[model samples]
Target chain A: MLDSLLQFLITGVTVGSTYALVGLGFAIIYNASDVVNFAQGEFVMIGAMVAISLLGAGTPFPLALLLAVMATVAVGLVLEALAVEPARGAPVVTLVIITIGASILLRGVALLVWGKDFHAMPHFSGDAPLHLGSATLLPQNLWVMGGTAALVLAVRQFFRRTSAGKALLACSCNRTAAQLMGINVRRMMLLAYGLSAALGAVAGLLVAPITFTSYDSGVMLGLKGFSAAILGGMGNPMGAVAGGLLLGVLESLSAGLISSGYKDAIAFVVVLLVLFLRPSGLFGKGAVERA
Target chain B: MHMRKRFFGLILGAGVLAAGSSFAADPIRIGTFLTVTGPASFLGDPELRTLQMYVEELNARGGVLGRKLELVHYDTVGQAKEAVTFVKRLIQNDKVDVIVGGSSTGDTMAAIPEVEKAGIPLISLAGGVEIVEPVKKWVFKTPHTDRMAAIRIFEDMKKRGIRKFALISGDGGYDKSGRKQVLELAPSHGLEVVADESYGNKDTDMTTQLTKIRATDAQAILNFGFGAAPAIVTRNVRQLGITLPVYQSHGVGSKKFIEMAGEAAEGVRLPAAALVVAEQLADSDPQKKVLLDYKAKFQAKHGEVSTFGGHAYDGFFIAVEAIQRAGGTDPARVRDEIEKTRGFVGTAGVFHMSPQDHMGLSVDAFKMVEVRKGNWVIID
Candidate 1:
């Protein structure tokens, strides 16, 4: 029983780490602009797909990875410039809807380019499993969990330490006040989107080996990440990470202990319970008036 | 006045003769509705291609029953409601004599009532036993049902002397039906299911379920699912280092599954239509010639010849043969001829239709194939 529990935890943490990375992207964008970027998942898909296509074309793995990340970042910036920026000062709900539209458009383009076949990426360091007591872990699982932790820490430091990150936080807190203080709010928004896109791409690249990717692979991942962000505390990057891991672990345990069929249901029920009890989320602060 | 009436009668007689001549030379219309451009496009796109290619080929060879074939098709985009609407249009607007389409079970089931009402024969390409079992009078499917696949896998297990196994399935319609069939048929085969687990359609990881299965004393594992999930399950089963034999349903028969699963798919067994291993079949095998001929013709035009296209091939040829045997496009006669299909060599199997069996295929239609070095090799 203990061994099975360990196995479940291992699987959960690995799965959750991907969700954490995606959730982090959601949290960052939500903080910078009060719009939930529904297209965040598409960023994950684009990252992996671009890398796969590049690798298929005989490019080396490392170069393909770098180019794919760069391409995804460019797409993020483009999305903000064309879709988000043009609708600046629009209602948050409308902006969210625009992101949803952008996601559909991105998915459509991906389908046209890649067709409707699932593509596999060779494991980063081979597919040999690492044994831990009675449990086994893939080298790719380590990449996902470690990569997510490092990205989370880096994002936290960016918000807390860097001047540009601080400026972005200022914009999130109050755009007019930040502008008054000579902060280029638009540039900060662009940076936030770029950083978020980069995070999403890295998650995709890490998880692609474990889960084969197609054009619309990101839809489910994106939703899970969104849930993780909401569960952790919508705008808190660190909370989003925690929420993602927590959600993954919960799903794994429930699936292991109760039933695999009810895994998603059980996890989402917990999220719903959390929301009902604490509307601001597990780590979110209370709502404050700004007038 | 009498002379004017005679002139009118002469004109009427000329009009009747012209209509009668045109009727003899009129093309026989075969209506199709497939999920051509959606998520399930993988199944429908090839099916539509096969129908078009064969219709063209048949017409080139002087057509079926001395009349050219006209294929009137619509893209359902994997929608059941669209399938119903398209079937109605085919029956009412196009006034087609026969229908041979419906790429998925949902679409096929939805279109059944309309075809039955219109008294037109429909040969569906979908893989649900419900489409034929309990037998709809106007409906017949060409592909082997999920139930037959389950029975085939179980029979192989029983023959190998394996009594206990675990089943991991996806929650989709196809997978759920397959899982249900396996469980329902296990006891009759003198087999016991030690563990049964399921995963969501879009789940990326299935290690937890596999881990749970590992704790069980199951002698082997059978995965019943379609799409990328089965590959993931296969990878996870290997990753956990559980060396028990793995079996998959026919849903993963295509080479794409092997490509996605990579080396992990080696030694994994599944029951698939003979079309998948066409080149590997012995010379004496009856389906070898038909399979090779269809594969070559299809590959010449469109790249790969999936079993989906093969289903369409069987469906089209069966309909065409029935029309020829009927000696006309009479709806009732054509339906009876399709039911009377016996010893008909096609891509799927040697179909033998009876009043009780609309699909006209048994478990023998599936050849037990194993993934050997990333290619399918027939084991039985």
Candidate 2:
């Protein structure tokens, strides 16, 4: 019984870590740009598939990974400049619709290009099973969890210590004031969006070997990551990570302990119920005052 | 009278020439419609690959009936309405001699009326018995009927001394048909249906449904869903730590399931087509050799595993066999030859199609497989 419980925890924590990465991207983008960046999952998908294909084609894994991340960051900058900047000062609903539309467009593009097959990439660390007590975890799972933690800590440090990172935060807190103080809010938005997409891509590449991904995988993953963001705390970076990991782990545990049939329903219900109980989410920045 | 005779003679000559040209070198075009994209793609994507592989093999084994076999493909997105349109295009625009495909039963069911209108041979890969029921003259199937699977499930459960069972099925057409079939047959197998829980395609939760099911005094669970749906079921079954025997439909063989469900999927029983289970059988067995070869070849080419890809593999190879046997691409001749196909070793098993049994196999064609340590293990 204890062995199975440990097993569930391992499974949950592993997937939860991936969710954390996606949610972190959401939180960072929201913090700077005040846009949800609904197409975040596509970045993850691009990173994983592009990296895998490049690696498969004999490119060094590190080089492929770097290229995938950079590619998404570039896409993020372009999307912000072309789409978001043109719709500046638009209603939040408009931004939502446009980003959702962008999500659909990205999905269509991925389908057309990739030709609809789930690819297999080699595990980041290795394929050897790691035994923890009675629970066995794949080495790749550790990489995902470690990578997420390191990313979260690095971002936290960057916001506190780096001048540019501080400028990005200042823009998020008060764009008008930041602009008045010559913080260059538009550039800050570009940086934040770029970083967000890059993070998503990194997460995707990390988990590529463990989970199967195809062109159609992005929408559902984006939804789940977004749900984690909302559940964890929409604008709070740490909260997004916490919420995602929590959701992933809870989902695994539910499937482990109860009926696998109800895991999806169970996870969503918990999210909805949590929202009802605490609107700010487990770690969300409480209610925000509209500018 | 002389003018009339000359005109009649000219018309006859023209008809004979036209017929002769059609018989000469023009490859008989076969149209394939499948879910090459979207969420249901896991089912169709491999199917398309298998189809491509078989077509290549047939071409290599000497062009079918001394004419090249041409396959025109389309993506159905696994929807019935999409299938209807695709079938129309296949018949009217592509001018195909035969239409084969249907990874999803709903799509196949929708394509039937259009195929009947075209007066062409239609062989479906989807396993819903209703697809052939009130049987259409031109429509045949390569997959065993869902009714056959229902019987096998109940019989397997009964054999294991499971007198009580619960059902967790999606509200899809195939699921509904299979569930109804199980209800009809379970009683004969000395099993009582304790509960029937349902979910929709977009549903992200089945906790309430599963909770209700768990409350019942059932000895086993029969789950029917595709993609994340059944994976969710498998996880929930584990989370609840329900010790009941869990059986999932073969439709859940997507790449996403293992990643999502992980260890919770261990020990789940599935009514797998013989093609997949043959991997666990002894190497000395001829069927095992075929299954292993198909798997090895498919993995080498496609780099992933699919449960029902063998259906598509079987479909393409069987059609080629018929074309070869008929010695020509004449639609009627090929159709008759296909109907008479017997003891032909296929990826799935020896197919024995008759005038009545167009699918060429039954429930017995499937072997029960269990997920053991993250791999499939054949059980009897």
Give the fraction of reference interface contacts each candidate recovers.
Answer: 0.89, 0.00
Distance from true position, residue A36, model 1, in Å? 0.5
* Top TM-score model: 1
Residue range B1-380, candidate 2, lDDT tens digits: 00000011233335545665332477667788888766677677888878766665554444466665667788888778878988898889888888778888889888988888777788787877777676677788777667776776777787888889898898666677777887788787788999877765433334445655666898999997765567766765655556688888766544345555667788888776666666568877667877777888898988765656877877777777777788766778878888888987666567888877777775667777778887778785
Could you give the TM-score of chain B for each candidate, in order?
Answer: 0.92, 0.84
lDDT of 1 by residue, A1-291 (tens): 999999999999999998999999999999998789999999999999999999999999999999999999999999999999999989999999999999999999999999888989989999999999999999999999989989988988998999999999998899999999999989988998999999999999999999999999989999999999999999999999999999999999999999999999999999999999999999999665554
- Each candidate's interface RMSD (Å, one decimal) is 0.7, 8.1
Query: Candidate 1: deviation at residue B90, Å?
Result: 1.4
TM-score for all models, in order of appearance: 0.95, 0.70
Ten contiguous residues with the weakest lDDT in model 2 chain A: A127-136
Worst 10 residues of 2 chain B by lDDT: B1-10
lDDT of 1 by residue, B1-380 (tens): 00000011233335545665322477788999998887888999899889988877766555667676888888888889988988998899989999999999999999999999999999999998889878889999899988889888998898888999999999988888888898999999899999999999799889999998999999899999999999999999999998999999998889999999988899999999898998999999999999999999999999888999999999999999999999999999999999999998989999999999998887888999999988999988
